[model samples]
Target: ITLPLSAPGIAFSLVLVFLLAIGELSVPSFLRYPVLPVLSFTQFAASYNFGAATAAAVPLAALALLGVLIESALLQNRVFTFRSIGRGLLISLGRWNPIAAAIFGLLTVALVIFPLSALFADAFSLTTLHDAMQRAGASIVRSVIYSAIAATILMALGFLLAQLTRDRGQRLVNFLTLALFAIPGTVLSIGLVRLWNSPMTWFIYTTPALLILGYTAQYCAVTTRLSLAGFFLIPKTFDEAARLSGASWTQRLFRIFVPLSNRTLVCAWLAAYILCLRDVPIALMTASPGGDPLPARILTLMANGAPPMIASLCLIMAIASLIPLVILARVIPSRGITG
Candidate 1:
């Protein structure tokens, strides 16, 4: 569960290295000078200085407060106001919990809102936003095309595989699907690279076709699983009825299964498309110079210390990722696919 959730982030980080490498080319001359070299030194010095000051101030403040309370008690010659102190402490503690919870909530909100705010803010900037939009526009278009083409191929294969198998081989097919899910994008990329590094596959390796192949391989199981689920939802009666009515397997599949499973088919395609769009590790590892995806492009900005541009690109990518999700949402409502 954790693996699936973290896979995207891990893949994002891996691709980010490549993005930064590209962004580093744009570093300003002044920042490249002595000021840049001293950054680490300044950070280290500030940490130690702040730590010492905080340490000294906390203890000193504590002692001063203790002394003040003691003096006040002594001046009144009242050894202690136990009841009053206890009531005040209880009141303070009662107030503190809600305040702390509010603060915690605010912090969490800020963690989410701030970065997004910064991204929007940066996108409004004339120069960086223009550059990001121009670059991202091209990359997004290419990636979408690549993903769509790959997903279509994967969906066809998955549908055929699902149609061919029955109870006896279903377990084996499912195990193979699960195996594909378990394989990391990096490992898949390596396998692809090895397979295509040969002379006969040289043209395939260097083209956008290679990236498509990698995506199809990675996401084929997703399509299979979705198609399988959709297939199961379809009654066996449809097939049997079609056969009794003099329909061949192909005609039955086309006339009944395909029409009835339209929603599932669309969903499977959408799922594969989303997975392909978000794919970073395999794309990054296997992408030829011509086939970089949007995620790969955003990482380039992050690596260059261009947080503003990176934020902007991230926001755009977030929206891009959500498109399929939005479609899925709209789709489910109409299809009666409920939780």
Candidate 2:
């Protein structure tokens, strides 16, 4: 019975995972998986064949657009009753519980625990972590700064977009974000390069602004969606009462809507920041020649880097991602998790 209502969430999740898989760069490149993103990057960066790169990305571009359209359709002019999840009765697992637990435990060990253990052992050796810090300190700091700026911009825009589309989804904004996100990062970087490469726009192209723009364009979809969920939780009556008393839209937004949705706002910012921090192709393509972010630095070191050194670099990346993720976990209410 719950499955019927779950269909929308399940479909969105499937599309989300599909887009992530298609946009992924590191694992596919490292494992030599011949994925679309890798092929597109190679065509654009290595071969200098823009036409071929664009052609290779057509399928994923369509796929990302389809996901956005489906998302809009799911949300279009509808009041989401996510709380209705409680209406269904739980099915008892009986004897299958222990078997299910064992399967999950083994999978967790194999997929998560074992790999992390290996990475920890290799990364924490004498001088490895220190060396990684020394080598990538500037890059890590730069990543954080860039991620911060981009996240702030994204958060503001996401809130505004969420407000604009409170009743209906914003088609153009959604489409633009999907284009930047679904299309090859390399292709987007190249487009940015061409757009702002000239002396007139040197300030943007030569600085971290270019990287921030790429991050904003790609992740706007994500932050907006997250923000919209928070927006939905707000009572329209609150806004109405404030307006009747002559509270400006800005005042109500900052004083009422914002505080009520503070948790989700933070979640949106954190999500955008992490996405920006971990991105590879865009940073690699747009970063200053000597000032690559940690992810970009890892790729650079991968060719001739020692095992310990690479592991340490990767460990630093993991830690950077983990701190925010931990906070995200905490900020989420237990009821939210159960729901």
Clashes of each: 4, 0
**What residue pairs are clashing in model 2?**
none
Where in model 2 is the C-alpha error above 4 Å?
Answer: 73-90, 168-172, 335-339
Using TM-score, give the best candidate's number: 2
Candidate 1 colliding pairs: 19-299, 19-300, 20-300, 20-303
lDDT of each: 0.63, 0.79
lDDT of 1 by residue, 1-339 (tens): 666755644553444343222212113222443222123222223353433433333433343334333333333311111011222223345768998989989997798777667778776677876777776778888778888898899888888887887434655665455444444454455557667978898899988878888888767766776676677666788788888899998898888778877777777788888888877756665678856888667655465646667766777777777899899767755443211
Show the lowest summed lDDT stretch of 10 residues, model 1. 77-86
All candidates: TM-score: 0.65, 0.89
**Cα distance off (Å), candidate 2, residue 115:** 1.0
